[model samples]
Target: MGEKTLEEISKAMRDIDITMLSTYAANGAIASRPMSNNRDVDYEGDSYFFTWENAHMVGEIENNQNVSLSYQGHKHFLIAAEGKAQVIRDKHAFKEHWNADLDKWFENGIDTPGVVMIRVDATRLHYWDGMDEGEIVLS
Candidate 1:
């Protein structure tokens, strides 16, 4: 097993629906929660997730933009991404990443009140497939 490229790692992540989003809490502790990408796994060193504006994670992100995302796929494939997160309240941006599956969470879709989107732009990506491991640093 040799080093894996971003495209190859992205392909492996296509089926991974959920990622553990980690943020820094106000108390200086690390907080983590499972956030579904809603199948928006196009890679490109960026990931998006929708949540309410009042959510704790939102505040955490506001306090510290540095965040991490962990993904696990079949066949012992695992990926970890370190990035900076931005909270987006723009409805147009929401619509861009919106999908039918998200309707279950946001009843009014992008029109839902207080809805915000978190965009994590990965600066570093590390992947491990069984005994093989590699890392990619995005510019």
Candidate 2:
């Protein structure tokens, strides 16, 4: 029934492990895929997801940096984030966001060749829960 702060929204996001990451496809169509957060969400208007360099989403992000992420949690909490994406290839950056859960996808973990990280810097976050809904703009 009241506006929510970024911190409060971040707290709600902790329980959300997967988010739908949407991007603009090369064919001018909107594409979306489920991305695991690996519970690495510290919020602060930023989110990260790892995928292979050759993945379709990577190509999509390359063509268009603008992206959106959708998240749903218990208690009717939902979030939609609009942001810009950067594809990171640096190993150091990989290590920073890497976790054991990712080993299931990347056989060698952070050392896995062709592994790339997509960093989404959210410029705006909109959320809804029950009868409450609000938006947070990040500068």
lDDT by residue for model 1 (1-139), tens: 3588888988888899999999999999999999999888777998999999999999999999999999999989899999999999999998889999999999999999989999999999988889998889997
lDDT of each: 0.93, 0.93
Q: How would you encode candidate 2's per-residue C-alpha lDDT over 54-93 as one tens digit per residue? A: 9999999989999999999998889999999999999899
Give me the displacement of residue 18 in model 2, in angstroms: 0.5
64 Cα displacement, candidate 1 (Å) = 0.5
Which whole-number lDDT from 0 to 100 does residue 25 have in model 1? Answer: 97
The Cα RMSD of model 1 versus the native structure comes to 1.0
- Residue 138 accuracy (lDDT) in model 2: 99
Q: Using Cα atoms with residue i matched to residue i, what is each candidate's TM-score against the true structure? A: 0.97, 0.97
Off by over 4 Å in 1: none
RMSD (Cα, Å) of candidate 2? 1.0
User: Considering only N, C-alpha and C atoms within 3 Å, which residue pairs clash in candidate 1?
Assistant: none
Candidate 1: minimum summed lDDT over ten consecutive residues — where? 1-10
